[model samples]
Target chain A: MSVLVYAENADGKFKKSVFEAVSYARAIADQNNTTLTAISIGNVAADELSALGQYGAHKILNVSTDKLKNFINQAYASVIAKASEAEQADVVVISNTFSGRGLAPRVAVKLGAGIADGAVSLPDTGNGKFLIKKTAFSGKAFATVELTSANKVIALIPNSYKVIENATGAKPEDFTVETNESDFKALLKEIVKSTDKVSLPDAEIVVSAGRGLKGPENWGMIEELADLLGAATACSKPVSDAGWRPHSEHVGQTGIAVSPNLYIAIGISGAIQHLAGISSSKVIVVINKDPEAPFYKVADYGIVGDAFEIVPKLIEAVKTYKASA
Target chain B: MNILVCISNVPDTTTKVTFNANNTQFNTAGVQFIINPYDEIALARAIELTDGGKGAVTVIHVGEAANEPTIRKALAIGATDAVRVNAPAHDAYFVAVQIAEYVKQHPFDLILTGRESIDYNGSKVAAMLGELLDIPSVSIIKKLDVDGANGTVEREIEGGKEVLTIPLPFVAGTAEGVAEPKIPNMRGIMSARTKPLTVVEPVEVKASSEIISYETPAPRGQVKLIPADDVAKLVDLLHNEAKVI
Candidate 1:
């Protein structure tokens, strides 16, 4: 029995999360005394898939299917399920992404295995049972889960685990799996991508604004700061509801849940619902005019001033710092 | 079009979380439970869809007798009937298995639920149930529109949104943009008293994952005060101490 990792690829290149998932699966395979193999689908190149060896993938299973170029849940699940059976994989790893979120549980059901999504750490094998810790309550707390079944599926939360690069020269082997088109019921007719510069979930640094920004037209300062820092721009739920920003950029319990490395809140009061979404960040900096804003209670750093005046200075400082660095 | 909407009774978002003596279970004392915000969107969407066509909306819950109030709340909102799988929610996997088992007996044209429960925050149930039923599933859906034979759903991706079309009998996890949940009207609230609410014993669920313990997050650090005029000092602190800049 070996560990199989579903390496995610977009437009033929492996995503950054794939390397992290490979690093995680490598550790699990080492503990279990099993080989760690990766499966690549769609238009991915053999050489590119093989290059994942730097992340500890012993071998890559290259399944090149033209129909699998775009994500169709049913087809992808069937392909991964077939690959798992072929490799006799006892443990399967996937990234907790939009695609993974849609496919991981389906694959788990196909394998009749126990699934743990939003996993934050590797499994603890010291005890007789293998237990994985996952973030629950939207990163408010962690829950240690024991996967007692024979087959287990885990979806590692993105950007949570550090990627270990060994630069080991591992080769990719070409493997083919036949998939029937009938299994794919849902069709991805088109993909409409937002023109946002940075993705909130993948952004290491996020600059978020709230109602204090006054109006959507006055968001230029926040955007400038985020642009200079190379960070994603976010808004509070109220801002989104008021049409200051798109609902996709709303960060709160009712909005998009995010856990970036550095989250900078501007003019947000830190309601419990909003805090529940972003409280998992490594460092939190709150900028508000009110000295008694609740966001300061949870912030690692705080600036008690108007966002309009403070944000421009922050932007200039970050620009100077980036230039110097 | 028979729509199935699943609702989970979870602590209100404002509730401060605390653990029991052993930290194996969540402390429910002094905590107010409500219909999950995400599931409320699902319920509203189901009601709207059924109201547009010749269909009925049914709400289902897998919990003990204590959860009946929340079930009644769903019925009071707009659901025509309700089903309570009389069992304590064991875990995400166990609960999914039980829901899938119950769903098999009653086929639904569309299945809707919240993206994740506020308490457990496990977003895997919809996909798991879809897999068990061998149907397509989408999560984090903000917009949903259904025709007689086909349906369209818009799900939020990392940087963008994906608009996909699938046939009927698909699953969708409701997020914010689906629709604002409407408070039950006086007519609906009174009518809910007569709606059918059937509670069935839960089937045997194979539990694979067990919670070991729980711990609260680290306490908030002391807040620092900086004069409004000393913007440079604030920047220095951010650059040097906080290192976020």
Candidate 2:
């Protein structure tokens, strides 16, 4: 009868997507005339779970088990299923990140619920039917789906909903659950984390280079601009395939999908695939030598010139503005 | 090791999406179908894992009879056999239920699928299957290595990546950079016909979600042209009109 949200964390800190998921869950709870409760896994402290009260979580369920520190899908799913069963949660909400994408569906199956991923908005429950709108075709279009089942699971698309914060306080109870033996056929042995200073997906501003940067060696300007703006660096798929950038930094349909507030494309022609991954950004700035480049078609702003000469000036301007402000 | 890879038949990435007159269903006329790109990665990883000749790789598809060609393509890609549940590919939960039924009958050491299907972008099937099987699952895995009885997986996070090690019999959704997808060789293609493909009727699980309608994205506006030589003016336009800087 109530909405349950999965609050994700990394290294004991809450991820920004947790707020977004809570926001969506709050709306669902309001519609259902029930309170929203959040569940935290891994090493999240009670204070951290209580902080979610600002996002309209009336109560928080903290499943703080030592074995749940790292994400084991089976273990995490088991805990969530147990919580859902105990709470009798009709609606489940999660962020559409790696963990949620992997865990939400499985949880839905266990609950025998209908699932909607990449949901951009809250469901319409006014007509006695639950209809949710989600982005499909890599964010190209929208699909209105009606969940006919009694239980429903939704994975909210990141950055699509506004995170609502209210002045509220609540003390959450610590709930401990028993995890059974791992049933995964594949066992995880170790974790190797990249030490990059700027991670593209989490960056508010992203400076991306494309083939127009000429080669990998000429990436000084792009890096300089990114450094000046305090932004993460990304590249188009072609640039990644050509070895100009690491495969992890590729931002396109075939690569990582990003929705930063500001996306700056340097020396890149906009292919449809590349556009699909980045079109959801709040603002798009395209820099290409060709005025007729396809990227300009979707760009809110364009700089038609050599990136080598233009990037430096832009960097200088940003520095001057920051210094003055 | 018995690796089970799930493949979905979807419209090619470049296909022009269209809707019916009533906007109730996608226009399927003349649309070419191909193996879901992400699923291809899962299939490739499974084949590579089994290529050492220790275990076998099997591909499964839950779709109509017309999807057999796509299922055979997985065999051609190097799976030992294929299975097709004869049912209209319904919602994500429905499809997951069908696959779970089949998987329960034939247990696997590993299950792999694409992070999400390109067409629906549901991103739910692998997780749903994991829940149904009561197993561990990981999504958007970029790097994976398996040793004797242990597997290490790297998943992409918002700003960084997470590395975890677990035992076998887990589900993983493959994204790019996990492994290069393999093309079917002529020999494999020729031998695919001889491979076993089991067809079974779908279970009585119902779809929880119903598609109300499908619509194409609005056509992109015309391109704005700026003279290439006027870099300064272009910068000003970007700052004032575009407001991106």
Candidate 3:
């Protein structure tokens, strides 16, 4: 049996998260001593489909149909399930992105496979059982889940692993799934792209502020710092709830959960819900006036000071460093 | 319109996560449970959508009798009635199967669930129910509006948002912005006790997965406290020591 992975693409180009998912699947394939096949749905260039080979995919199944031009959860799940069955896949992996989150569970139901979403670690096949570690309780804790079903589905969290290059030079073979009108029940009416400087999920560094910023007008320095570092600007739930920031910019347990390489919190007291969302961040830096702020406990670096005074200086320092380098 | 909102009772967000019984089970001692926050949002939206007797909102939970209080909270918040499938929410598959079975006998025009449970963070129930019932399912919807027999929903993607239209008899996992949660007023709380709270035995279904154990996150190292005045030093440490900048 082979391991199957759904190679998600955006506007015909694969994102870094897709490669990371393929890399994770490759490791699992190696562990199981099986081949890995990646399925690409919608319209993707031949070269783009072949790129999956770089991530250890022995074969790529390209499903470029006009009917499936846009992402319909039901249709995409049907396509992935069909591809998995055709390949005799025992394990199916998908990136835990927004689209993948919607598609994975449906695929699991269609295939009658057990699923573990937000998986942070590869399956531990020790003792003849498959146990996978996943983030639970909104990243506050971890749970090791055992998938007893023979066919299993896993949604790998973004940034959980680095992408590795393994050249397989695999060619893309055309794969097709029969579709009826029912698959298109959910019609995509329109798409609205955010004009933000940097997307939070894909950002390497995130500059987030809480209500401690005092007012929405004081956000100039936070934006300046984010612009200098090419980072996304996020806010805590309170700030968003108060209308200081858009709800999309809110990062916390009840909001968007992000795990960037570096997360810098400015004037944000570490609420447990807010901390739970960013605990997976690689490095955390806290800048607050209160030393008793709980954020410093989990931070890699802490500076007890006012954001108005400290943020400008930090921004200038980053500017100087960039200029000098 | 009859709406079905599925709720999960989870530990309060502030509870410190811990494990017991050789790490095989969550330590429930001295911890408080509440309706999952995301599910609360769904329930709130369902109540708003069915406001003024336009329709009825039904909340269903798959858990033991101990979670009845949580179900009552839904009714207090404005659900027309409640149902509890008498079983533990062992896994996503098992829970979805139980809900689907109950819904098969008692169908609804619309079904809503939280984008993901705060405890397991598994966004599986809505889509699974969609497949089992042969209906379209959308996940993590930020906005939902009903007009006639069709509903419009907006959901965030990686770098953008998408708005879609689906006919009635569909499922959706609600996120923030769907509706602000409503608290239980005294009048509503009093009336909730008289509202129907139906308990039914769970259908025969085998869980496809189980949590083998639970573990807390590794403790972080000591923070390197830097004076606020010396921002340069902190920047240097970030670049050289942490290599993150």
Error of 2 at A204 (Å): 2.6
Tell me the tens digit of each residue's lDDT in model 2 across A167-282: 35867777788767754343555555576566776677799999888899988888887887778899998898887788889887667778887888998888877887787787
lDDT of 1 at A189: 66
2 or 3: which has the higher DockQ?
A: 3
| Candidate with the larger lDDT of 2 and 3 | 3
Candidate 1 Cα deviation (angstroms), residue B107: 1.5
DockQ of each: 0.66, 0.52, 0.84
Question: Which of the two, 1 or 3, has more TM-score?
Answer: 3
> For model 2, what is the alpha-carbon lDDT of residue B113?
89
Best-fitting candidate, measured by TM-score? 3
Better of 1 and 2 by DockQ: 1
Error of 2 at B86 (Å): 1.3
lDDT of 2 by residue, B1-245 (tens): 89899999988766767778698878889988999999999888888888878789989899999888898888998999999989988877777888889889999888898988888888788877777777677888887777876677888776567777756777788888777889999999999999999999999977688889776545545545555455555446545665655
- lDDT tens per residue, model 1, B1-245: 89999999998888877889788888889999999999999999899988856799999998998988899899999999999988888876667777788889988999998988887776878888888787888877889999878999987776777888989889899888898897998998899889999988888877767778776667767867676666667667767887766
Q: Per-residue lDDT for A1-325 in model 3, tens only? A: 9999999888899999999999999999999999999999989999899999999999999999899889998999999998999999999999999999889999999888999899999899999999999999898889999999999999999999889999899999999789868989888999998865788888889999999899999999999999999999999999999999888889988888899999999989999999999999999999999999999999989999998899999999999999987
Error of 2 at A45 (Å): 3.9
Candidate maximizing lDDT: 3
Candidate 1 chain B minimal-lDDT segment of 10 residues? B226-235
